[model samples]
Every structure is written in C-alpha cells, then in structure tokens.
Target: MRLSLNQWTTRRWSVAEAVDGCVRHGLEAIGLWRQNVAEQGLAESVKLVRDAGLRVSSLCRGGFLTTSGKAFAEALDDNRRAIDEAAELEAACLVMVVGGLPGVQPGEPLTAGASRDLAGARERVAEALAELAPYAGERGVKLALEPLHPIYCPDRAVLSTLGQALDLALAHPEEQVGVVVDTFHVWWDPRVFDDIARAGRRIASYQVCDYLHPLPEDVLLGRGMMGDGVIDFKPITRAVLDAGYTGDVEVEIFNADIWAADPDEVVATMKARYEDVVLSRP
Candidate 1:
C-alpha cells in the first residue's frame, strides 16, 4: 500500500510548507484541508503537489448536520465548493465529518439536562449526504464518512463507530459514499475488526494515528508514534489489506506538541515510525 500524510498533522504550517514536508519525507500522497487550500489558492496548491510528485489522497473535511433552513443550505453549498476544490486537486475522496447535535455549536451553551437528538442528527446527516452524493458522483469524487469517536458525539460528529458509518454507507449503496478508517477513532471499538472486514473495498481511505489517553483537541500528545501506542496496528493493517484495500495509509496526528516543532521534523519522524512499526509488521 502507498503511504500518505495529512496536512492536519502539521496544521501549524502553511499549505506550501506542509506539501514540502510531505515531499521531503518521500510520502507518495497527502490530504489537504479546506482551510489550507483556501489560504493558498487551489490552483497554486494543486500545482505545488503536482510539482512535488505527490497525489492528493483526500480532502480533510465537509459536513455539518446541526443547522437547518438557510444554515443547512449554506452547509450544502460549502460542501459543493469543497467537492469542486477536490476535483481541481484530483483527490481520491472528500472526507466528510458528519456533524453532531442540532442547534448546538461546539462550546455553545446546552439546555440543562437536555439530551441530544442523535437519531434526528443522523437522519439529517443521511439526507445531507444523499443530496451531496449525486453531486460528488458527477464530479467523480467519492465521499468518505469519517466516524469520529463517541467522545465527540455531542460537539464534533455523531457517527461514532465504524459499524455505524458502514451502516450509513450501506444505506446509500452509491459509488460516491464510502467509509474512512481512522485508527485513533476506532481503535477502542469492540467490533472494529469485524467492521474493517465488512468495509472491505468500500473503504475509501485509511488514517493512522495513536492515542494514549482520552480524546483531546486534534493534537499528538497522548498519541505515541504508531507502535508506541497500545493499538495492535499490525492486525488492523493486515485486515485492511486482506479486505482488498490498497489505498494510501495516511498518518494524521492532531498534536499541539508535534505542531510546535518543525514541520519537516515531524514528517520525518512519522515516516520513520510508520516504516519501522506499521509497515514492517508481518
């Protein structure tokens, strides 16, 4: 399988700087974020990746199920724009972080003892995905649903597990919709192995990162380099390969500590760890 790195690992850097780091580490692919692309103009960013001989594996994110009416419409429009940007960059897929609770933004005040309407949020996600799928399909870009951990259920994403994400994708059954397997999100799941097998070829992309403690903001803190973490990545990697996934293994660490260091050093360290631990495993 080819190896890729996500710009999020070094979100502290500029888009150009991130691309340069990926190339410097000999990574074959890289995932770009919407914010990063916007900062450097799509044409220029695309050109930079091409010039460095790197493939755009996927775009970082798009999807918010919280708002309604004008808010929902605006979200859809932004996703379409993201799709267009992904097409311009020739990315393999547009990763979707399906949103959480309705009418509640992250860090917003919550009603006392108010339970989140998870089912409603999921239905909204499905509807939004259905609407966006055809558009993404028309652009020849796949939509990858990245199931955030349950820790993010209220604020970040409602799709909390691989099984749930696969269920959503199966419901759609369209070529445009698929699932992304991120180790950090799914490692603690009891059914992760089973879902990985189930995902099989429907796996749109794979992300590698480690978590030592509880969910924190996107940073590398508790995340030990691949093997340094508690996860059994070898079996997971083998399962993915056996299930017919030959896509790039994209390393995505959201650690503040790592970001504070030089971007190039972080890339190099991740590449070396991936090669020594995950890749070298039998």
Candidate 2:
C-alpha cells in the first residue's frame, strides 16, 4: 500500500506536526484538511510538507453546493479558494463532498418548503460541478467527487454512490474531474465491485477505513480503524488495484477515540494496520 495519513485521522496534529509524524513513520504522503492548512497559513503549510519531502495526496474537501442565495455563493467562493490551496500544496486532487438538502443548518430545523428532495439536490450539485470544473482544471486541480453513504444522503451528501459520482465526473473531461473510492462509505453497496471496475482511470483517490459497530450519537465520528470492523479488505482492495489506480492509499478515519489517542501512536497503529490488512491482498 502507498500509505498516506489523512489529517482528520489525527485531528490534533498541526500540519507541521503531521508532516513530521509521517516522516517519522516512513510515510511519504498525507491528506490535508482545509482548516489545518488555513491555521498554518497556505504558504507555510505547503512549505512545511514540501520541506519534509511529503506529498499532499488530496485536499479534504471543496463542496457544499446545495444551499441557495448567499450560502451557495459563499460555498463557491470557498471552493475556489480550496482549489487554489490544493494547487499551491501540489495536491493530486480536491475531494468534494457535495451537500445534501437545503435549510438544514447544523443545529437548526428544516424549514417548511425545504423538505428532503434527493433528486433536486443532486441536480444542483451537478450544476455546481459544471461551474467549477473549468476553474479547477485551469488551476491544475482535479475535482474528486466522493459519494458518501446513502445514510448521509438526507443531511450530508446527495451523491451517495460511486456510480452517481462517476456520472457527474463523466459529464466533464476525465482530467478535470474524477471519483473517490472510499471503502468506509461505499463498502455496503451491492455493486461496489462493479463500480470500482467501471470507475477505472476516473478514480482519482482511494481511501481506506473500517466500518465498526455501536454507532456514536454523532454518527460522523463512527468510522473504525482498518482492521477493526467487519469490512473484508482483500476484495475491495483487489478491485481498486485491478482498476489501475496508482495514487496514494489514504487512511481517513473519524472516530473520536482515534482522535483522542496520541498522534504518533495513531500513525504507528495505522501503518501497522495498513501493512497487515490493506497491503496484505494487493
């Protein structure tokens, strides 16, 4: 496995610290979150990683294209900045988590007319992608559309399957856009293997993490480490490898417990797990 640690998996580590940790653990790549980059300043963040000889596998995200009016406008502007940041960091792609339904702010209630409409939200995401694809291409950043689990469709991402993500990416040129095959999100899909083959060269990023039980109250933090869950790594990994994806294999977990552990220990465990499981098959 071409291992890369996503910054979110060790959220407490700064960009500088994360890079140092990666180097310490013999990792040569990392997936950065926007907030962490902003904290270190874009130039400093880029320098920090480059100075350490680490590759920015992908930038965490650059989408939320479902809101209307000012919210939508702000999302576009933020995404534009995200594209610039990804280019500056020499990242391979900008992962996009296209937003879900409208009017459901974090703590707020859904408004009257802003009911759940999966088709409408997905259409809006496609339109937004059409608008952003050219700009991203100009900046030399491929837009990597990631389909979250169907459970997230109601409140997080409208693109809830790899096939749907590929549909949107195929609308544009291959160089300008691609899909992300994240194991935790797509593992339960009945057609995951076929979709991986179908994704082929359009697959820009491959992420790994296990699916654990005992759902947390905050479901976003429920992801498990690679070998701790029920996911069968060999088949999924073989499918991705067979698809001809040569990019970094990133470990992106959201478990609160993982975040609470020592960053260095987390990376060590991640490396061990990747060696034992992810790399064991392919």
Candidate 3:
C-alpha cells in the first residue's frame, strides 16, 4: 500500500510547498484540498504535482447539498467546478462531504433556526448524488462519499456511517461514485468491518487518523495520528485490505498540534507512525 499525505494534515503549507515536501519524503501520493488549489491557482497546482511525480489520491471535497432554490443551484455549480478542478489535477476522486441541515455550515454549532429533520437532509444528499454522479463520471472523476462522525451530522455530513455511505453510493455506477473508509469516523461503529468488507472495490479512499479521547474543544480538530489515540489500526486496516482496496492509505489528521509542527517533520512522523501502526496489520 502507498502512503498518501492528505494536504489537510499539513494545513499550513502552500500547494507548492506541500508537493515539494511529498517528493522529499518519497511519498507517492498527496490529497489536494480545493482551497489550497485555489490559493496556488489550479494550473500551477496541477503542474507542481505532475512535475514532482506525485499522484493526487483524491481531492478534499465537493459536496454540500442541503440548500434549496438559488443556494442549491449555486451549490451544484460550485461542485461542478470542484469536479473540473479534480479532473485538471488528474485526481482519483473528489471526496464528497455531503452537507448537513439546509442552512448549517461545517464545524459550526447548530442554531435553533437550523432544520432538525435528519431524514430530509439525507434525501438532499441522495438527490445530489443523482445530479453530480453523471457529471463526475463524464470527467472520469468519481465522487468519493465520505461519512463524517455522528457528531457532525448537524453541521457536516448527514451520512454518518460506512454502511450509510455505501448505500448512498450504490445508486450510482461504481465508476461514478464510491465510499471513503475513514477510520477516524467509522472506527466506533459495530458494523465497521462488515461495511468495510462490503465496500470492496467501491472504497475510493482509506483515510487513517485516530479518534482522540476527550475530543478537542473543537470536535473537528480531534483526529490524532495513527498511534496516538485509542484506535487499533491493525484490525481496521486489515479489514480495509481484505475488502480489496488497492489504493493510497492517506494520513488525514486534523489536530492543531500536528498542523503547527514543521511540515517536513509532520511528513516524517506520518511515515513512521504509518509503518508502526497501519502497516502492522497483515
């Protein structure tokens, strides 16, 4: 398995710097976030990775399908742009964090005004897949649906389990959409292994990060590097491998401490922890 550094792990680095750091560390792949790409200009970001011979395992995001009317239309247009950007970078997939209630934003607290009907929010996600899948396929890019933890259901992804993500993705052709098996989010579920097995070829990305105890004040920043928290990487990773996922196993941490460290050192820590933790299985 190849080790991929999801750009968010080195949150402070610019696109050029991240690409160079990947090469310097001999990492074969990197995951790009749209904000970073926009910061560097898509063409320049594409060239940087291409010149460095790095494979973009996946693009950070391309979904937020909870709005309606004008906002929903705008969201669709923005997602199309995200797909186009991913295509330009030759990314394997555009990771989709299908958004929460109609007006809630990611990582923010929900207000009384936000809709509380979870079922309706999920329906919007299904509608989004029907709308975006064909477009993503036309560009040879797959929509990699990611299930954020249940804590994020009010503000981030309404889809909150690997199984839920898989069911949502099954509506589209495997080439048009697939699921991301992020250990950080799914590790706590009892059916995780079964879902991982079921994912099989539909597993577009396998992001590795641990769930920390006493989750950070901002629950969004609670992901720890592989060996730093309670997760047992060996079993979860074995399940992913057994599912026939032959793709980059990305280290996608979100801890403030990690993001604050030197970028190169972060890469080095990722490599070591990856070997000692993730690869320790099978």
lDDT: worst 10-residue window of model 1: 215-224
lDDT of 1 at 75: 92
* Candidate 2 Cα outliers beyond 4 Å, as residue runs: 106-113, 280-282
- Candidate 3 lDDT over residue span 1-282, tens digit each: 899999999999999989989999999899999999999999999999999999999998999888778888898999999999999999989999999887776766667678888898888888878898999999999999999899998888899999999999988899999999998899899999999999899999999999999898899999998888999988888888888988998999999999889989989989999999888453
lDDT of each: 0.83, 0.89, 0.91
Instruction: Estimate candidate 3's alpha-carbon lDDT, on a 0 to 1 scale.
Output: 0.91
Q: What does the lDDT read for residue 79 in candidate 2?
A: 92
Which residue runs of candidate 1 sit more than 4 Å off their true CA positions?
Answer: 107-115, 214-224
Query: Between candidates 2 and 3, which one is better according to TM-score?
Result: 3
Decreasing lDDT order of the candidates? 3, 2, 1
All candidates: TM-score: 0.93, 0.96, 0.98
Which residue pairs show backbone clashes in model 2?
A: none
lDDT of 1 at 95: 94
Residues 116-187, model 2: lDDT tens digits:
777788878988888899999999999999999876776778888999999889999988999999998999
Cα misplacement distance, residue 104 of candidate 3 (Å):
2.3
Candidate 3, clashing residue pairs? none
